[model samples]
Target: MALHNKIGKIGEDIAVKYLRQEGYYIIERNYRNKFGEIDIIAAKNNYTIFIEVKSRSSENYIELAQSLYYKQIAHLRRAAIFYFSEKNIHLSLIRFDLIALKIDPAARRIDKLKHFKNIID
Candidate 1:
């Protein structure tokens, strides 16, 4: 895979790990439909979280989180709506999140990981 794709996959893994650590049950990963794909779907304590992951090898060169543009956000929103409607979910609350990851291939470690909650409508 290309470096970016690899980084993104790593980011998704990290996000899943972190969410599980936080007591969130992973509902799905890479959930896809006609609209688009959601990187992660999690549920806990009556709340559902829809996550978008962005990863970069080196943020010193380019920030990873900034890659999620307006159009991307729009698609995510559309996908979330579709998911809720298709699942017939009527939950107490729902949230959107962005998981930003920076990986160091040389070190074989994560340089940084940031979770931004409520990132979308």
Candidate 2:
């Protein structure tokens, strides 16, 4: 994998580990549909979460946030709707989350990880 892809994969693994630690049970990773890929899907306390994961090896947090545009978020929402309908899953408490990670790929270390819960609202 290229450096960026490597960083992203590593960052995702780190995010999954952190989420498990936080009492969330993972249901999926890299769930895909026409809209795109939902990086992580998990459940916690009766809430099903759709997570968008952004990862970077560079030290530019602003860049990472800027990379995800409004259109992308809209696509995610649409994709979430498709996921619910396709999987035949229903729950009153559903959430959209954003996980941002800054990592050192060489060492496979997560320098920072931020979980922004309910990002859609």
Candidate 3:
């Protein structure tokens, strides 16, 4: 794999750890369908959260938060719908969350992670 891809995977691992510590029960990691991939699917406060994790080496030009484009959101929404129907789960609530990770070279770790929920209507 390329270096960037490797770094992204590392960031995702960190995000998963962070979510677990925050009391989220992880149902799936890297959930994929014909549409796209959801970085994490977790249950929290009686709702299922579909997370999109974007990691970056710098906050230049674009911050990690900018990665959640509209097309991606649409794909995620479709995937979420498929997930619920395929599993036959009558869910009352669902959320789309964006997790941003910025890597700090000086600290040799992720400098920060931001979780944004309800990203779509």
Candidate 1: tens digits of C-alpha lDDT, residues 14-116: 7799889989999999999999999999998788999998877867423655778999989998999999999998776989988887777656567888888
Give one digit per residue, the lDDT tens place, for model 3 in 1-121.
8868876788788888999999999999999888788899999999999998888776631366676678988999999998888899998899988888887644548777788778787
Predicted model with the maximum TM-score = 2
Rank the models by lDDT, top first.
2, 1, 3
TM-score of every candidate relative to the true structure? 0.89, 0.93, 0.90
Task: Please report the TM-score between candidate 1 and the true structure.
Answer: 0.89
Model 1 poorest 10 in a row by lDDT: 58-67
Q: Residue 26 CA error for candidate 3 (Å)?
A: 0.8
Ranking by TM-score: 2, 3, 1
- For model 1, the superposed segments whose C-alpha errors exceed 4 Å read 60-62
Reference-based TM-score, model 3:
0.90
lDDT of 1: 0.84
Clash pairs detected, candidate 2: none
lDDT by residue (tens digit), candidate 2, 38-116: 9999999989999888989877654565577899999999999999999997877899988888888889998877788
